[model samples]
Target: MVYSHSQVQLYKQCELRYAYKYIDRIPVPAEASLHLALGTSVHGALEFLYKEVQRLKVPSKESILEEYHSIRNEQITKIQEENKRSQLDQQQVADFAHMGVEYINWYYSTYHPFDQSIVMSTEEKVFPKLDDDIKFRWQIDRIDTQDDTFTIVDYKTSKRYPKDTDETFKDQINLYGRAIKQNYGSKFKKLIAKIVYLHLRNEIAREVTDEEMEKTRIKYSSIIQEIIKKTQRRSNGDKEAFKPVQWYRCDSCPFKMICPLFAHNYIHDEAVNLDDMKPTTIKAVIDEMAQMAYEIKRLKEQKDSYAKILGNYAAEKGYKRLYGNENKVIIGKSENYSPLPEKKNELESKLASENMLDDVVDIDRFKLTKKFKEHELDYDQYQDLVKKSVSITAQRPSKLKEKEIDEYMDIIGEE
Candidate 1:
């Protein structure tokens, strides 16, 4: 199984999507949103700036902006050529590109001298195996040393700043800091992590204590264990290994056409099968899939999305289905749901008396939690329902901690 904050977070958000992406190796939509474009261009510009600064020369602000423009323009062209985005038009793309440029310019003005620390590496790959079955990799954006402290700097370009209290971002820095500590133990007396908000022209820095690093390792190891357990169960013919957590996120998933819940009504049997596909058949099918992905993205972006308006309206009218150009939209609610909290105990007792307790509930913790909310269950009720459902996850020391792993080599010492 693959491991990264993004991948693990995706599994946590929707395991079915994870299976589609990692297990099935589905090709994601080629057209990126403007937000992604900004991050990519900014990251490229900063990588250039740091690499240049480390060589004992700081480029003029104009020169740095010029590099940013080149990157943003090239990326915009690539995005336009892909024609994968439905919500973003050409003008919006240009505007987002300009926004990135402005942010980079602001970044330059804020850090004009570029003398805070010596940049050791940018976009360095860190492949640290957690355990035998939990091997994975990640990339550190930047690592710089100043005095006794080594700073793991991550450049974040976004309209909104990352929440300082968010564990995801915190864990992200920890992952980088731990990697640095493991590989460059003798080089620095202390290690700290910084998330540079390029858009805001400020950073949120923190010291990733040894305790936090160890906790993060255990936390990450547990997620990997759950993923491994699900995969093993799935291979042994457990069809329930990955279950849907439907929401707006589904609107962005590329494999929606073939996703079990939506496929029967939304897709034809003629959809591409990558396993048996020939080179000649790839382009046309993938292009079509991208179009469908764009359509879904567009619908979701609309103020009155189809899922809400059409599906709900049709269901209200007691219509089982509605027709579009060549597809049928299934209008219905899911079945086998638990009762509302106020009535849950009574219903549970009834089911138990009828010998239907196990057959009546989905029993998956996350799934049950979501189901509980949809049924208007109280918070305490949801907690009670899920108390016994939390699965235990096994943990282990990373291969690096045990000195049974590959070394970072030149990345740790590169100038």
Candidate 2:
């Protein structure tokens, strides 16, 4: 099994999705989204320009811009067939194009290749093997040697810096340091790694401490072991086990139509409605749904408390508001509205009247019951009933821990 930061992130998100993507080898169409294409083109252009500069070729800004334009145009043209008009607007296209240029310019300006001497290597392939049957392979964007230190520089196109401590970022850097040690001899006295958030215009740099590097090795080893276990399980006929975990990204997932959990009637209906909605409108709906879910949770809790209080005052004829205005609300018997028929009692009576009972046929079973007590049924039948009776809403996972954040940052550095 080969592991990368993205693979780890995907595994963390949903093991099934990771399985679908990597283990199953499901083909993903080449993304034609302008924003994604623009990012790729910009990275390509920068890589080209940097390599040229590394060779002592001081190309003018105009020449660099021209090369960027050529690459950008080619990419756009190649994706034009798949480009739905609604997928990207003129303004978005122009904005991404401008962003690509800005990123390239920032790369050139921030790290002047002409002035700096090349040391380790550019786009170096490093594969670190673990005790488990997993291989971690990553390509460094650029590695430079300065005095007694080895600096690993990774260029990022994103505008925001990761919201984490410097120590967390160092773990990622240390992985590169370890990779370097494994591949090259441990001749370098110091190892420095940096993630250049080009859009944010911030370079988060950290030096790997000895203790931190050892921790990184252990962490990577653990991850490798987990990956191997998952891979082996997948290979042993657990196909559905690799199903993509449904997340926010699932809405854009190519296999949404195939996913059993996310491909239900409600999700299908929502997908159809979403196709007709504007992006902003869809976003607004999502926000409203989040608020509604929170409100529902609060309302359910209040309802539960109210039910408890009502049980104590079964003889009472009035309802009282709790924790709000000190106003009393009365519940009176009503004759104007018809009451709903008791379906459970009707079914019970029908079953009793039939008198065709067997050991498995219990008349008392025909009652409205809570879901949690339905464990007598098989798992699949129980799941189906639960799906029909209630809606399952997903909440955002807990915040990334300090150590996890550092590991992610390290992977970003490698990227």
Best by lDDT: 1
Show where candidate 2 strays beyond 4 Å.
Answer: 84-88, 117-119, 165-172, 266-415
| Candidate 2 lDDT tens digits, 1-415 | 6677567667777777677777777998765677667766766666666677667787676677788888888877777766545454678778889988887777677765545645456778887654456567788888878777777888777656666663444555677777777775466787777777878878887776767767877887785666666577568875643545557787677766557754432231132256656544433465567788778888999987886676456436344433337755343333673324767566556657887435325434334243333323444556654443556765642333565445445545643
Task: Give RMSD (Å) of candidate 2 vs. truth.
Answer: 16.3
- Cα lDDT listed for each candidate: 0.74, 0.66
Q: Residue-wise lDDT of candidate 1 within 298-361, one digit each (tens)?
A: 7778935757798778867888889889888777676685478899899989999999988866
Misplaced by over 4 Å in model 1 are 84-88, 267-415
TM value for model 1: 0.62
Find the number of clashing residue pairs for candidate 1.
0
lDDT, candidate 1, at 112: 79
Query: Can you list the residue pairs that collide in candidate 1?
Result: none
Q: Total clashing residue pairs per candidate? A: 0, 7
Q: Could you tell me every candidate's TM-score relative to the true structure?
A: 0.62, 0.61
